[model samples]
Target: MRQMPPENPFDDDKLKEECGVFGVVGVADAANFIALGLHALQHRGQEAGGIVTYDPEAGFNSARRFGYVRDNFTSQKVMETLPGEVGIGHVRYSTAGSKGATAIRDVQPFFGEFSMGGAAIAHNGNITNAEALKRELIDRGSIFQSSSDSECIIHLMARSLQRNIPERMKDALRRVEGAFSVVAMTRTKLIGVRDPRGVRPLVLGKVGEKGYALSSETCALDIIGAEFVREIEPGEMVVISNGVVESFHPFERTASRFCIFEHVYFSRPDSILGGRSVYETRRQIGVELAREAPVDADLVCPVPDSGTPAAIGFSHESGIPYGMGIIRNQYMGRTFIEPSEQIRNMGVRLKLNVNRALIRGKRIILVDDSVVRGTTSQKIKDMLLDAGAAEVHFRIASPPTMWPCFYGVDTPDRDKLLAANMTVDEMCAHLDVDSLQFITLDGLYRAAGVPEGRDANAPKYCDACFSGEYPVVPSDMIAKGFEMKTAAE
Candidate 1:
C-alpha cells in the first residue's frame, strides 16, 4: 500500500472540480498508466478514486476506494489484479450521487454488458436533464443501479439502436442536456467525448507510437509523458480501436463555451489549454486585477498555494513588494473537529497562520482567486488584524461569483454564496477588510484570451457564475422553480 497523506484541511472558499476521467489504449500496463494520470488529477476530486481495466484473458476488472488515488490505486498487489492493455479511471468528488458508503456503487468506470461486448465509462460533469431522464427511463422499465446522473447514459446507451458502442454513446449523449466530458473503454476500443457546448474539458494525447490517451487535462498527459495531440473539440467524439483513431461529430455544432472556472481554479496551473498556459492565464488575471483595482498597500500577500502565482503577477503590476504574510501548515488534516462555537471560530487558524513580522504595521493586499462564503476571508482578516497589520485589503482575481455553477463545478447555492447575497460594499463589511475589489468580468475575459470582451448577445464562455448567462438550461433547477438570473437581478 502507498503512504497516505493527511486529507486537505484547507476548506477553500471556492468552487470545486467534480471529477476527472482518464482512459488509455494500446499500452501494456494501461491501468498503471491510468493510475498515474489519475494521481496527477487528484486536485480535481479527492473524495474517491477508481480504475477499470480490460484484459484479454481475464476480461474487465474494477477497484474503487473512498480516498485519495495514491492510497488506493498504487500498490503492486492492486495493479497485479487489474492487468490489461486498455483501461479507464475516475476520481470523484460527488456531484450526482450520495456521499455515503453506498457511493462506492456509484463510482466509475460504470460498466454495461451489451449483446456485442462490455463497455465501461468514466464521466466528468453533471447532466442537467438527469432527473427527468431518470424518471422517463424508469417508466420505460429500466432498473437503475446508482443515483448518479452518469448512470443515465448507460441506460440510454442500452436503449440505443446504434450498431456499436461509440455510435450508441453518441446516441445517448444526443438525448441528454448539460456538460459532459466522458472517457470510455470497451474490449477493443477506447472512446472520448465532449459536450456540444464544451462546458467541460477533455484532451487527446499520444503515448509514443503505440498508445493514445484521453484525459480531463493536459497535466494528466504530462505525468506519464504523453504528447498532447489536441483538445477533443466540443460536440466531437473520438474512437480509438486497434491503435487507430476515428473522429465523429454527431451533435449540431455550437460555439464552445468551455468552463472559465477551469482556468481559474479547476485545472492545474502547469496545464495548457487552447495553446495557452493555465498558470500564465492566472498570472495575467492577476495583472488585469492589479490594473483594474490598484490599492495603496505596503505588501501584497497571497492566501497561499493557489493564490501564489496570481499574487506574484499582482506584485509586478502594482509595483507592490509581495511577501509571505500568511503561511500554511502543510501537515494539517481535514478531519479536525470544532466541538464548540469558539473552536469553530478558530478553524481558519488550523490551516493558516498570520506572519506577524511580515504583516505587522503594514497595509497588506490579500490576493485570492475567488471568494465563495466570506467565512474564511473574515477569519483571515481577524488573524491579520490580531497580528497588528495596519490594514487588510482584498484583491480577488475573478469577478464576484454571483451565480451557482450547474455544470460540474460544486458551487454552493446562490443564497449561500457571499457575492450572490451581498453588494461589494456589503461584502467588504462582511469580510471586515479595509477594502475589497474583484476583477471586472470584462477584464477576466481579456485575461482568458478574449480581448474583444464578452458579447452580451452571445457570450463565448460559461461565465454563468459571474454574468448569470447559462449556456444550457438547468433543467433540474428549473423544475424546482429556480430562475436563472433572478438571484443576480
Candidate 2:
C-alpha cells in the first residue's frame, strides 16, 4: 500500500510527536474506554492506531488499523471483536520504524507469545539502542516480525529466564536504553513503566471503585472518566491486577529530566504534566517571551491553534491587543486529497487564511511555538503581507530548535532545521519579517516551573533540541556519524 499523505502536506512544518499509549484494566468493555482515551491523545500521533484486549474465553484479541482512532476504532465491527475487561491501545506517527506508506505490520500494540504467557505492549518513546539490539537479537536467531524498534522489548522478554511475564518484562527493559513509557498487558495484569530519565510522560489514574488506567497524559484519563492519580515516576514500573497495584523500581535511580517541549508543544493544552497545567505553562511561556523579546505592534496574532495560548499570554504581558488575524480551516483532515499540482500549489492557504480586515495596515506581532524548516513561517508571513499588513514581527515561544530529538519526537535532521543553520538575523531576513525573536532557554525553564532558571551544571528538563545536551545518548544515531556537542562548544 502507498503510504497515505499527511493531513496538510504543505503546512506540516512542525515537529511531530511520536506516539501515545493508554491502557485500562477492570472496566467493562475496556476496548471502548481505550478508544476514548486514545481519541483524547490523537494529537500525539495520527498515522495509525491499535488496541489489544484479553478475555478469558476469547484469549488475546487485537485490531490494528492505519488511520485515526475515530475512523477505525469507533465502528461496532471492530469493537465487537475485541471484548475484554483488560485492554491497551496506541496511537502512532512512526518515529522509530518505517517512514512513509506504513505497513499494517508496523502498526503497534505489538504482541508476542512466550513460554510463560502471551503479552502485548504499546510504547510511547523511541529506543536509542534499537539498532544494536536488533543486530544482536537477529544474530542470536530471533526472527523479527516488524521493523519497529519497540519490537525489541518483546524479543528480549522472550529470551529472559524470568518465570513470570512482569519479571521477564523488567529483564527486557533493563537491557534497553533511551527514553520510553511503555504500557503492556499479560493474562491478568496491566503494566506501565517509564525510562530512567522520565524523558517521556506516563500517568496513572483510577476509574470507578475497582478500575485503573495508565495513559500518556491526564487528558486521556479525563476522557474515560478516570481520576488522575499520579505520574509513573522515572524508572518506576507499576503492575495493576484485580484492582491492586504493585510498584517497582526496575532501573537504577537518577535525576529526572522530563522533556521540556511537553510544555511548549506536543501535549494537549488541557493535559497536566508534573502537577502543572500544560495550557497555563504555554501561556507562561508567552509571558516570558514578551519580557525577553518585546515588540511594539498594533495587534498580537498567533500562528493558529498551537500558538494561541502563548499569543494570549504575550498580549497580556506586552499590553497589546490580541486579534484573530489568521484563521485555520478546522475541517481539513489527513485524508484530504490533492490530486493535482494546482491544488498542491494552494498550499498553506488551504489550512490557514489571513483576516484582511484585521490585518490591513497593522504592525503585527506573530507569536508562534517554534520555527522548524522555516517554510511555514515564510508562508504565513507572505500571507500577512499580501493582506496589507504593514509589518510582521515574529515572537517564538520556545528557544531555537537547533537539534533533532531521539527521545520519541520526529524532528528533521540537523541540516534541515533552519535554526541550526541560520542566525536569528539571517532567519529574520530569510523569512522577510521585520523582526524575529525566540525565548531564551532559561526563560523556557522558568515558564516550565523552574524559577531559578536553568543551572547548566544540573538543568531540570530535557532540552536537547535547544541546548544540545541529550539526557540519554542516542547510540544508533551516533553510530551513523551524528555528532554531539562538546562542553567547550
Candidate 3:
C-alpha cells in the first residue's frame, strides 16, 4: 500500500488548484522558455514539475522532479539535456491518482508514441468519466503506466484509428467529459485545446518573430515576454507550426462556463481572464463584500498575499483604515520541515505572526479568500486576541465553499467542509469571532463583470463550489456512493 505524506502543518484552509500547463513551439532552446513559464505558474501547483522537449538528434527528452520549479528546473545541466525547439511543461498538485504520495511517474507532460508519430501532453483539469474509460481500456489490453486519469488519454489516443496525431487527439478528447485545458506537442507542432464548457483556462501567446506559446494563464506568457494573443475558445483546438496556426473545432459547441474561482484565488492577480483583470475583479469582490456585509472595526487587515487586493477594495469602500495587523513570514515555503510534535504544534505561527504593537486595543476586520476546514481561521482569531486585539470580524472574499469541486481543484469532501456543515452564525461562534460573513454568490458574479448577477437557469461561469450546481456530473464519485443535491432539498 502507498503511504501518504504527512500533511503540511501550516497549510492554509483554502481549496488547492490542481495544475498548470505551458508549451513553446518554434523557439530555440524551448525548454528554457518553458521553465520560466512554469515558474510563473508555480502557484497553481507547487508539489512537482516536469518538462519535455524534442530534438531531431535527441528525439524526446524529459525531466520530472518533485519540488518547486525554481528549485528543480533552473539547473543549466538539466536544461542542456532537454535541447529542442519545441517543448511543453506541467506543474502539478495531484487532484487525481496517488494524492499526497505523488510518484515521479505521475508527474506530467506524459509522452506516448503512436504509429503515426510521437506526442507529449500536459493536462490541467479533471476527467469525470476517467474510471469508466480506464476500465474499458484495460479490458481491451492497454498497458497502464502512471495512476493518473490523464494517462487514460494517452491510451485512448493510442487506440485511435485517425490518420494523424492531431486527429487522434481530437478523437481521444471527444470521448472525455468534465473540464480540461490541454497543452500538447508533436515533433513539429504545438497544440492547445479547451473542453466545451471552458471550465479551465488556456491562452495563446506570440513569442519573438516566429515562436508561439500556450499557457494556463496569461501571467505565464508574460514571463517569456510573449504577447497575449487570445484565449483558446471552448471546444476549439489550435495547432501551430513554423509560425503558422490552424484552427479546428472538434467538439459540439456549448455555452462557456470558465471557472469563476480563478478570479477569487487560483490565478495570479496580474493575470487577465475573459479579457478582465483578475486583480480588478478580486478588488471589486471586496468592494461588493463591503457593500453587502459592512462591519465597523478599528483596523481592516488582510490575511496576507491572497487577501491583499480584496482588503484594499474593502478598505476603500468602507472608509476603514487598512493596517498590517497580521504579518506573514515571506520566507516560509509550504515544504517547511517540522521534525517533532512540539515544532508541529507551532502550526500557523510558523508562517504568520500577529503585529503585537499595531494589533493592541484595535478592533480588527480580517479579510480572507475562503475558509475550508476553519482550522486556520480559528488559529488566526486566537492569535489576534492573544495580541490584545479587542474584537475580530471575519470577511471572506468569496461565497462560502459549500460543495467540493470535481473539476481540477483539490477541495475537501463535503463532510469536512466547514460551510457545508454550519450556518454563518454557527461558523462565527465556532471560530469565536465577533462576526463572520461571506460575499453573496450574486455579488461575486457582479464583481466578475456580470452586471445582472447569476441566472438561476443559466450561469455565466462555473460557481459549483459555492452554488452546488455542477455543470458536469461526477460519475466516478457517484459510483462511490457520493450523494449530490436533490431538487427538493
User: lDDT value for candidate 1?
Assistant: 0.88
User: TM-scores across all candidates?
Assistant: 0.96, 0.98, 0.98
Model 1 lDDT per residue over 252-361, tens place:
98988988888788899999988889999999988998999999989999988788888999999999999999999886644456347676556779889998988889
Ranking by lDDT: 2, 3, 1
Candidate 2 lDDT over 1-489, as tens digits, reads 011234557656898888999999999999999999999999999889999999999999999988889999998988999999999999999766665554678888999998878999999888899999999999999998888889999999999999999999999999898889999999899999999999999999999999999999999999888999999999999999999999999899999999999999999999999999999999999999999999879999999899999999999999999999999999878788854789887778989999999999999999999999998999899999999999999999999999999988888888989999999999999999999999999999999999999999999899999999998898999998899988775
lDDT of 3 by residue, 91-207 (tens): 998878685453788999899999878999999999988989999999999988888989988998999999998999999999998899999999999999999999999999999
Q: Give the 10-residue window scoring lowest on summed lDDT in candidate 3.
A: 1-10
What candidate 2 gets wrong by more than 4 Å, as runs, is 1-8, 99-102
Pairing residues by index, what is the TM-score of model 3? 0.98
RMSD values for the candidates in order, in angstroms, are 3.5, 1.9, 1.6
TM-score of 1: 0.96
Model 1 bad stretches (over 4 Å)? 1-12, 335-343, 486-488
- 22, model 3: CA deviation in Å? 0.3
